[model samples]
Structure formats: structure tokens, C-alpha cells
Target chain A: MAVAADGRAAVAQTAVAAESRAVSSNEIIAEFVDVHRHYKMGDNVVRALNGVSMKVSKGDYLTIMGRSGSGKSTMLNLLGCLDRPTRGEYRVGGRDVSKLDDDALSNVRGHEIGFIFQSFNLIPQLTVLENLEVPLFYQGRVGAESREKAEYLADRVGLGQRLAHKPLELSGGQQQRVAIARALMNDPLFLLADEATGNLDSNTEAEILDLFDDLRPDGVTIVMVTHNPTVAQRADRTLWLKDGEVEKLVTNADRADAAPTEESL
Target chain B: MIRDTWRIVRLGLKSLMLHKLRSALTTAGILFGVASVIAMLAVGEGAKQDALERFQDMGVTNLIARSKKPAETATSNSQSLWSALSYGLLYAEADLIQASLPTSVVARVREAKRPMIRGEHFHTSIIVGTEPSFLELTNMQVREGRWLGDIDDRRLANVCVLGATLTRLLFPLENPMDQTVLIGDDDRYRVVGVLSEQGRTAGAGSTPYDECMFIPLHTHQRRFGDVNTTRSGGSFSRERVELAEVKVKMPSSEDVAAGAQVIRDLLAQRIEETGDVLVTVPLELLKQEEESKRMFNIVLAVIASISLLVGGIGIMNVMLATVTERTREIGIRRALGAKKKHVVQQFLVEAGVLSALGGVVGVTLGVGLPFLITTWFAQKTIILPQHVMLAFSISAAVGVVFGLYPAWRAANMDPVEALRHE
Candidate 1:
């Protein structure tokens, strides 16, 4: 029933998530159906995301865009599993997770989600390799193999030689790269990026987008929220929100068929 | 589980290292609290030991009766003073004390005033005439040669044992063994033994036994004749005294109280109208000291607890501020899939490590302070391992207890709001 707005992501759904009977979807890893969130300010209830619905599929590079008071932040928060829906159903891995308790929700967040922030919120005291191991740390995966994986991710992010350096010692672009590598630590179902390039220069922003493109072949799905049109154009589809509802889901038709572009920085 | 704890602890340490000066300053409160606990207890223990040794030297199971002149005799008739003024323990009284407690050992004593000369060295000192049992009753050890025996008393021998101090004065450059010391113009004695130094028997002054010259009772009675005469301002006065004191040592500590009561009853009339015929029981003194020491220890424990309480408060204050300052970090950790319990664990470990570091340093200082106190103040100090352990464990507990509120506050923060914190 929540498949109309983004049909490509909700393609093979056969059962309702709200009824506790989610049908198999090889593509859809996360879905939000008729979600509503409200904040009480004095005597009035203010609706943040009024009946918003969306779906994110495997290997799908999707971006969310909207103006102020458009429920953009609410969607980003819900997609990251940082907040559960006040009403309606949100599911991950064919399981309804909106009603899960704090501990179970924490487990889901730990094992199934990865988050990247615009400001690159790396713990300032930890070395680059240690920061890359944080998500696995919560999953009790902090051992010899985790170290090797961290090293590999550091090299993948072009930070191999700077593994022992703290975030404060790195440039803003390099720190953001480290944050991206850290987000990939647990091999989450999808990467949730909140204005992932909002703080970087245009040249560095292009480099990060290229890195996302490089990871797409490995079946790494990405869902980014941003206001920049150029950044939104890089994703396969951009969901635009207005007044807490889907204004439109614009497909970047050219991205599906174009070869990887080599942009000199 | 151990590995996880080790990782979190390492993380906490790294976080604390970010603000080294602040962490160290916060730790100071606990350090001094622990140090003062151990050091103060050591000093108190040392003082108790000093008192215990003195009471032991006084012989806890022994009773001492000393003779003092009657107070009314200070202004006796001037004409009567010229005849004879003798008011003290007579030889008969010494016999009474011995017969009263048959199982006890009794030592009778008489003091004589005279000047002794040994070649060029001349010293004026008190001569103590006592039985052979005096050495055992008073706990004095002879340093050289043998003490006076039964044969010397029977033969009225002119042999004497010099007190430790007197031996030094009379024979500075030669051995005093078998040396002749003239007691006055008319009497001389051969030194049989020299005594070992007796530390302050009671308090802050040298022992009276150190300066005394001991002679056999039979010899003292025959030579001095019980009458001492003095001539001054063309007037002469004579005082006759038979015995100075009687020290009685009971067979066991249990016999002391009853024995003391017996002496009190027998000497009741002799003690009338004067502070003379005074009796001293060291066991009673020892009991009284134990009671006072227990009270003193309670007071010390209270003071130590107050110091630690204040130290715990200091830790809480610093931790609260730290949680507030690092709200952003807490949010970031939470966003990265950290649970509330994990956040709590991190901060708790930080607080524990901080105070435990202080405890370690405090134990070192506490153990060292007693040595410094012993050397500088010339007082004994004892450090018990249990005391060290108690202080250390309490300090660590203080940190955890005090850290609880701050850590809970950090863990329960709204992650979205915290992430927005500037």
C-alpha cells in the first residue's frame, strides 16, 4: 500500500509490514509507510512528518531534497533509525522495527545501519583506524580481524598511511573520507548520509561522489539527504518532500546508463 | 568480557589524557584524604606503643609503695627539728608487705645521700641499698659482672653495683669492674657490676635508676646506721629512716588487684594525714590507657571519613562538569550505535581510573610519611597493611559512588539534542 511514490524500490512487495506479514523483497532493505511524527510546543501539536512514505532498495544511490519545514530532517532521522515513527510502520530486513524497544532498536542500529554526517563527527581523540573500528566495536567485533578490515577500509578511502593520526590532525576533506570509511565498518544494509558533502568544497565534494560511485559496483547502497542540486543529481533518484509529504521522486535518468566520469581535481 | 572491559578502560584513559592537568587537579582531593588516613593512624599507633612500653617497664603485675614525709612536718617546732625528724617506711613495714603476699617477690630499699670518689673523679649521688630481689622486681639488667647475691648480703661485703650514669661519671677512662669507690671519708665499696641504661621509665625525663649506686641491704644498715645528720648555719639536725620503698611483684597479672587491696588495707594508718606510703599499680594505668586509646581511635576514624567524603564530592563536581562539556561526544557515540549502558560504562571507568590513580600515589605517600615522621620527630610510627588496603579500597569506592550521578546523566541525554549541542 506504501509503494506508489517510489515503485522501483517497492517492486516485489507481496504482504503488509504493518500487519506483521512482510513479503520477501530482494531489493528493499528499508521502508517507511504512512509515517507521522509530532512535537508538542505548549498547547499545540506540530506534525513534523505527516503521513510520509518511502522505500530504499539494495544498490540504490538515492538522495532526499527539500526546503526548510519540508520534513527533510525528519526523513533523514527516520531513515538512519535514530528515531522510530510515532505512528505507522518502518521495516528493515523484512521485519517491522518501528515498535522495537530501545535495546533491540540499538541492536538494529548497531548491526544494520551506517551513518555519515556533514560535519564528520569522528571522536577527536581516536586514531583514524580506531574510528573505523567503532561500529564493529558495538557489535563485539573488535579483534584482530577487525583491525585488518579497518586497515583495508583506510586504504580503500586513501587514508592507509594516516591510520594512526587523529581526526584533528587531518584536513576537512581527509577527515570526511575517514568518516565515510568508518560508516562502512559493519557492512550495513545501507549508508545513511545526512548532508554528506554540505561542509566540503565543490572540488572535494566531487571526489567524495566519485568514491560513492566506486563503491556502487560492490552492491553498497547509499541514501543521502542534501539541499545541493548538483549533489542530488549524482544519485539514481531524488525524493523531494513538501509539507511532510512526497512532493515528487525525480529519477536521474542519465545516471543509469552513463559511464563513470573522471573529474580532474 | 575481560577483553571488552580492557578496551573500554583503554578508551577512558585516552579520553582522560586529553585534559591531563584537569584530571590531575581533580585527583588531588582523594590523594590527600587517603594519605592522611594512613599517616594519622600510624602516629596514633606509635603513641600507644610508647605508652605501652612505659607501662610494661613499670611492671604491670607489680605494686610500688614509696615513702614520703608527712605534710604537717613542713613547719615542725624549730627545737624539735634539731633533734630528729624521721617520717617514712620503717624496716618493720617492709616486712609487713612481704608477709602479706607470700607468693610474691618483695624488694626493700633505703636511700643514702653521700659523695663518692674514684681517684680524681668525685660524684655526689644517691646510694640505693636493696636486696638481691630488687634486680628482678625492677626489671633492670646488669651490663657487666654479677649482681649482688645472698653471700654478699650475709658477709656484709663492701661490694656495689654502679648505675649506668654513675659508672660513666666515676670511671670515664677505666673499667669500673672491681674498682674501689670511697662512699664518704669513712666508707668505701668495690664495684661489682655496671648497669645497662634504662630508658625513660615513665615519661620525658631520664630514669632515676641510671644515677643510683646500689649496695647490699645488710651493708647499708651497718655503715649508715639509719641516721643522717646535716650541719648548716651553726645548727645541726639528724633524721633517721629505715626503709625508702617496697616493690612487690605478683606471680601473675591476675594477682595484682587483690594484692594492691591488701597493701591499701595494711598501710591505712601509716598513710594518715600525709601523702606518704603511696601505692602505685601499673596494671590499672595500663587498663585506663587502653580505654582512652579506643576513644582516640574512634575520633581518628571519623576525621578520616570526613576527608574522604569531601574528596568524593570533589570527584563528583569534576565529573559533572566533564559530562556537560562532552555532551557532544556522548551524542556522537550514541549515534554510532553505542547503548546507554555503554556510555555509562565509559564514564564510570574514567572516574574509577582517576581515583584509583590517586589512591596509588596516596598509598606511596602514606607509607613514606611515617618514616619521615619517625626521623624528624623522634617518635615511633607503625604502618599496618590492613590500614593501607582499607584506605585504598575506600578511595576507589568513593570515585564510583560519586561518579554514578554524572554518568547516569551522560547516558540518559537525548541523542539528537546532544548532537546539536555547541
Candidate 2:
């Protein structure tokens, strides 16, 4: 009872199977496909990112490793919806992101994705508590809910006693922790960390990583970009990028711990 | 939205508070501009009232009819400086008008003089003759004794009414009412009445009511013997009479025009030449003065408005600088989901509030200055009408016109770019 199948039909069957894998897991919270970000500087065309594609899943702590000019920050910008891809189909939670307008992208950043910068981009004039409430202010979700959420985050970030203090009054680690608490205030779908531990000491970096570890099991997806191998090793998966495109993708087990005091790659 | 605006306003206020000196300097321009407009307007109004009151002191609604010199007549003789040739209103003419009209009052006036009379115990005195009705004509009131009457005129009596200044000169220490004073040869005149003090008319020196004597008109005609006229011709051809004044009375201000028209018509019918009578009506002059005062007030208001406009420009300048200084703040507000309209409104309200406060101060100054000027100086008071809402309203308008540019700049900031700004 052998029925010979046509070559075209067999090829089509494999194509469907590959297409299934494209959206295989509802776990794929965000996807970047052949994204290019080109910027014009005077007469020269600077390719900030050259056709980079990667996927991040729910509860996945992924690290993006690259040198200074390797477009790691640009990748984080694309993920955080702070910037749009020059060309490519970028999707977040099964929604096509190329079509999203600037305001919509901001909304997504404000609601769906939270960002933490190494510089601790907290408004220096505002108190630590007020800094945590900033993203909520932009979300137009003011009142008791936002206040309670800010209070809870202040406690979680170990800045409960320093809530009334301004960013300038806090140390590097404290300010970065305040920024992290601010980023998590809206219960965002993913946390996009851009060199979050770059300015922190080893002990403070380990503490921040431990905070992230506490957040990951709560179903908060994390995508961290860093040049430090020690920071990258804390992630569940590592994507080593060179000149924008992914050179290799490895698991946390494959990324051996580098010297704690070693210089950032 | 209100909460956001409140925050922004608080921030703006904080920044302004930070640079207290600069803000005060900026506000100083507005203060000076506002205060100047108010003070200038008040002074202008006071000056106008001073001029008006001077006119009022002369007379409110009285008519003055004076005689003009005849066109054909000329005074070639140098001895006729005190007396002038007249071809118009005569003594008989005044009598004629009085007898015919059913008016409120009438008075006959004539001029006469006597040789200088000196008593053994007194100094030299100058005497002039006029009728008893002259007391009423000059709006005079006797301070001490009785005025000359009909019996005095009928008997050709030499009873006299002395002015307050003249009484002080003739009698010195004695009561002059019953005393006899010598005039010319073999003639003695009895003093009758002393008039109340008559003040000076607007810029005119030596009011006639101050030092003149009043006698019967008949006595004057006889005493002078037709020598009052400065004749330059043969006996039958010489023009007669010097100066004679006529006063026309009306029932009310509304009837002034009617009274004037009647007098004009009557004079036109009686006189052969039109220029014989130079008629002056106080009511008409008063109206013309009022119209000119209105024009003066408008000019003053326009000048004052320039200061207000300058104040408005000051507000605009401050607001524009504020927009530039708070560009980052504006950017932050825009990135925080504030619409362009919201941003513009916030700035506009801030500017409006600033100017409105300035306006309030200006209005107080405008109203307060006049009272202060009057209290400090012996001057006529200025009156501001209910329609002076322009003081505050114009300042507010200035705020709007000047504030628009800065507000528009603030509202038009791009959120994406603004959020990226440091």
C-alpha cells in the first residue's frame, strides 16, 4: 500500500513545517527577523545594525554579547521599541511591529516592555519614589494603583528607606537599583536591560543579577545586552553577536565564568 | 489634565523663584509701564479739570453782549486811550430789551468818573458811576450794608456802593456804610453797600468787581454830559457811547440756545450792521470747551495706551525667554503624553496670570493717583467714568497678544525628540 508522493508536494510539506517553527511556541514573546538599522552621518551611511535576527521567549533570560561597535545597544533599542527597524518583520507577542507608529511604539515600551539603562536615567530632580512613578505617569495610569505599585517596587529594590532621596543623593548601585525598580513598576511583559551592570561594582552587579533571577521565575521575560562575559553568564541563553549579525548562540552552561575583575569585552 | 498643568505651573514657578533677581527685573519693566500710564492719565485729567473750573468761575450759563468798534470809525487822538468809539449796544438799547422781554432779570450799565477826592483825614480816592442793578449783574452780594435802589436813581442821588477793597481804602477804621465821601466840587456821595470779595477770573488780573464803585445810571449820564464818547467827527456825525454790557437770562441749560437765538434775532432786526454787536454766550463756549476737553482726554488715553502696550511687550519678552529656558521641561511634558494644545494652554495661562496681576496693580495705581495728587496739592479733582474698564482689559489683551508666540513654540515640540533631550 505505498503511495508515491510528488517532489513539489514533499517540498511544500517541509516548508509548512518550517513555517510552523517560525511561530512554533507561544513562548516566543518577541522576534526580530533580518532587521537593519542604518543611519546617515553627513555623506556617509553608518550601518548601526546589519540584518540581525533573534527570538526571545517568555521567562527566558537571554544575553546579547558584543563589542562596542557591534550594535548590541541597537538590538536592545529595537527590542525595547525605543527604535524601529529600518527594514524587516519584527514581531512582539505575535503582533507585527513594523506597522506600529511612533506613539504606538511608545505605548508598547511603556506597557509591554520596560528598559533599564546603565546610566540610571532617573530624573535627578525627582525623589526615588517619584522616579519609580515616571513610567506610570507616561502610561496615564495615575492614582492609588500607581502609588501602591511604586511603593511596592521601592521596597523590592531595597530603596524603601531612600524613597525620599533624589538620584544625585544615591550611589551608583543605589541609583541603578532605583532605575530597575522604575522599569518594573508597570509589570511589563519583558525587561530590556542595556549594560545594566556596566557602572556597578562586582558585588553590586551580582546583587542586580540576583534581583533579575528573582524576577525571571515570576514570568517576566528578560533580554540583557552586555560585553562582560560574567554578566552574560547569568542569563539562561547567550547570543554572541559580531558586526550586528548573530555569530553564535549558546546556553548559559556553555558560557564559562570569566574572571570577576576582568575587563569588559 | 489639570494635575499635569498644575505640575507644569509649579515647575515654572519654581524656576522663576530660583532666579529671583532676573524675574524681578523683568517684572520691573511691567511695573513701570503700568504705573506710568496710570499716573499720566490721572495728571492729564486733573489738568483738564483745572482749566474747566477756571472757565466755570467766570460764568456757567450767562450771556455777554459787548459792543464792537464801528468799521468806519478810527481813534486818531492820543488822549482817547481809556474811552473807545462804539457803534453798537447803547444804554437805551439795554433799557429797550429789558422793557420788552419777560426775562428773569435785567440790568443797565454805564461808566462815569469823578475828579480825585481827598478828605482832611483820608487819602485820595477814585470814584466811578454805575447803576444799582450792577450788583445783580456782577453776581455780587453785599457783605455789610444795603445796595442802591429805585429811589436813589429817581432822585439822582449820589449814594455809592463800595467794593470790599475800596471800603478798606476809604474808611480804614470806621464803618463806611453811613459815612459821606467827597467826589467832585461842592458834591458829597453817601456810601451805601459793600460787596463781598470777588476772586480773580482765569488768568485775568485786577477784577473790576474788586475795586469799583456803583452809582445810579442816570447820575452817571448827567455827570459825564455826553463826553463819554470818543468822537472823531462833526457834531451830528460823531458816533456815540463807549462800552455797554448786556446779560441775558435763561430758565435752564436746555433753554440757553433758545435764549441766545432770540437775542440774536432781536439784535439783528434792530441794528443796521451785523458787526455792530459781538455776542458771546457762555453756554456755547462751555460746550465747545467740553468738546475740546474730550479730544484732549482721547489724546491722553492714547499716550497712556502706549505704556500699556510696552508693558505687554515686556510680558511677551519674559514669556519668550521662559519658553527658551524651559525647552527641556516642555520636551518632558510632551513626552509624558501632553498634547500640543495642552502645552500651549499651560504657557498661555501662566502669561495671562502674570499680566493680569500687573493689570490689577495698574488699575489700583490709576485710580489711586488722582486722589493722592488732589490730597497733596490744592488742585481740581479728576473724575474717572465707569467705562474705564479698558485699564484692566487692555493689559489682559496685551498678555494674550504677546504670550501667543511662546505658547505656540512650547506646544509644537516633538515628543520623540524631546524625550531624547537631556
Query: lDDT per residue, candidate 1, B125-153, as tens digits?
Result: 78888899999988889999989998999
Candidate 2: Cα lDDT at B284: 80
User: By DockQ thresholds, what CAPRI class is model 2?
Assistant: incorrect
Can you tell me which runs of candidate 1 are displaced by over 4 Å? A1-27, A256-265, B1-4, B69-79, B83-100, B202-207, B225-242, B254-273, B294-305
| Highest-TM-score candidate | 1
How many Å off is the CA of B142 in candidate 1? 2.4
User: Which pairs of residues clash in candidate 2, taking residues 3 or more apart in a chain or in different chains?
Assistant: none
Q: Give per-model TM-scores.
A: 0.86, 0.63
Model 2 lDDT tens row, B1-422:
77766655664454566557766666555555565566666666777676666556545555556665446533424325554444657776676666655663555555444443436544333344555555555566889888888888889997888777767766677888778777667677788888888764521112355566777767766766544543366432334554355665555567667767767777884345546776777768777877887887788778777777777777788888887767765654443334566667767877776776677776776677767777888655554553246566777777777889989987776543544455
Q: Pick the candidate with the highest DockQ.
A: 1
Judged by whole-model lDDT over C-alpha atoms, candidate 1 comes out at: 0.84
Provide chain B TM-scores across all predictions.
0.89, 0.75
